[model samples]
Target: MDIKDGKIKIAYLSQVPAPYRERMHELIHQDHQFSYDVIYCAKLEPNRKWELEYGNYKMHFLTDVAKTFRHNNTNVWALLKKLNPNVLIITAFKPTMLYGVIWCLLNGRKIIVYNDGTFNSEKSISMIQKQIRKFVYWVASSFMAPSKGTNDLYNSYGVGNDKIFRSCLCVDNSVFDNLPVRDREFTIMFSGQIIERKLPLFFANIAIELSKKIPGFKALIIGDGEQREEMIERLKQNNVDFEFTGFLDQKILPKYYSRAKLFLFTTKHDEWGIVANEACASGTPVITSVDAGAANDLIIHNINGYILPINVNIWVEHILKLLGNDNLYNEFSINALAMVAAYNHQQAAGGLVDAVNYALAEKNKSTQSNTITA
Candidate 1:
């Protein structure tokens, strides 16, 4: 907690080397204020197709866990023991992170727990699960959150402003900048895995309705998953003109994201849809469901985009309205760019450091109080 000669040794426990998070980690590593190391449970998940680009930073991957989608407590414990960090950052509430929490508790080290979940996404949590989260919240020295929904979630568990820090869930928005202005390609676009929660069939339904009113309604579908075939079949049956680009690399995504007139995110629940961030960064307006975590922070209703319920009729109405009205679409596009400008990698890294510093400061204060009592 004393920062041991001006650098607090920090260890982060994460699920994977997520592309969006890797950049933020690079920025945090560049900061001279703290010694940072990211210990990943795995290199990639079973579903992800990310092309990870590791930076010149301290990164350790659990080899045994990398092969499978599970974490070994022994590996996690051994790594934490070896790191012996002043503060440990836990990125999720899984069993793997629980092991880290227990290690931190036994070692008397400070802990900073990051929360990105919202009540809507966690509606099925049992009472026991809530109690476990409450316990984790109690053990944490500080909390890091990306959106207001996550902040409110922490507040609901009795966390106060003093212990909460803002680390926005962001991507490199600058990448989308400076692309040659070209005519928008697709009338509406949907990006993300074609899984049940993403509601790809619902998007197809919207496309069907829109094609009835608008001439030549073309939809763009990006990414792939178990539901890809079904989604495609539905779209075909509806006679909707569409294109499906299966699981593109991170670098190639900007071209598609930037070309769409309206980015449609009809998800049942998302912690924070990074695709929405990508869409806005590309100067394309978005129409997302209210259940998306980005709806709380990034997409302002009727400003950058519309955050509506999962009603097909309503989605079709808004899509038709935006596509028909050029003035409104342009206004939304401009606003989307302006709104996403604030959430960048730099800001996210700074927020993590702030949370770490706050935790160390609180630990030092507690140490002083104990010393006085003694």
Candidate 2:
């Protein structure tokens, strides 16, 4: 378990912003058995704050390639070769998995590719890309997906069940553990990008209906995206009492989780919403769509939270039920907090370490058996 002298070196190649990359890096690094390094393909210069905070990790800021191409073939293999990582894990499919699988095969390094889920029907890749992804799945030593749905997607591409493992997204327990206990204000909070897919308008409408029934009913929308202006205008037009925080700092987000009575996740389709985990960790129960990846994993319908259809009217009834019944709300909140323990950082890190160990052991056994045959 000794991490010193780099017992296990991990190289993560990502084009995403620093917050996500750094969070994953820190989760892995916390384990004494692993030493992690990140190769960030800076399509845009990282936030100054991110650079200042993550200054210690080995970061490669490249501007030559566009984000799409970087995800596909960003010379991550060249960097992987230099790091000589014992285990290589690629997030998302396509170019990253495609390149990482080839590099690991050529170099005899163990590889695990993580898929939150395969691309949605609307976002499905080209036939050529699907063929390439199938090949990547075939070559990878193991595959780690965040949800059963994602695992099924990998299997659909001919990846064996043994090669695929579920590693659901997680939150740092410490962040939630320290959240200040506050009175629930009978408010529902929706904290994700304002996009058509997320169906924020549905939640806004439900909130408007609930406000008429329950005096203190309100909704808080936190995040901005393509539909921000339109959503804002709609909210104003409807005269819904809601707070638009735009984008709040991660440090300040726990407070919102503490204050809200319920977390409303209206995404009609999501691979896995990590914000659901954040909500649970903050001791707030969530009312989420059955379509969310995390909903299947974390939410026990009527136990932890309700998993309702994506209909606004149905959502309104569920909200009113929770508002009128204190026992139901308290029960959900308590159960939700208890459920968060399973998705804590320690559990996730342990799952990753176990997956890596199994992949490495299988590789070693295969090598030794070949030597014996020779």
Give the per-residue Cα lDDT of candidate 2 at 177: 40
For model 2, what is the alpha-carbon lDDT of residue 36? Answer: 75
Q: Would you list the C-alpha lDDT of every candidate in the order shown?
A: 0.82, 0.68
lDDT of 2 by residue, 35-141 (tens): 77766555453222222246244556444335443355556767777777877777756465557667777777777777676435324667876776677666667
After superposing candidate 1, which stretches have Cα over 4 Å from the reference?
1-5, 64-72, 177-182, 362-374
Model 2, residue 296: distance off in Å is: 1.2
Each candidate: RMSD? 5.0, 5.9
Give the backbone clash total of model 2: 1
Mind sharing the TM-score for model 1?
0.93
Off by over 4 Å in 2: 1-6, 17-24, 30-35, 43-52, 55-73, 118-125, 177-182, 362-374
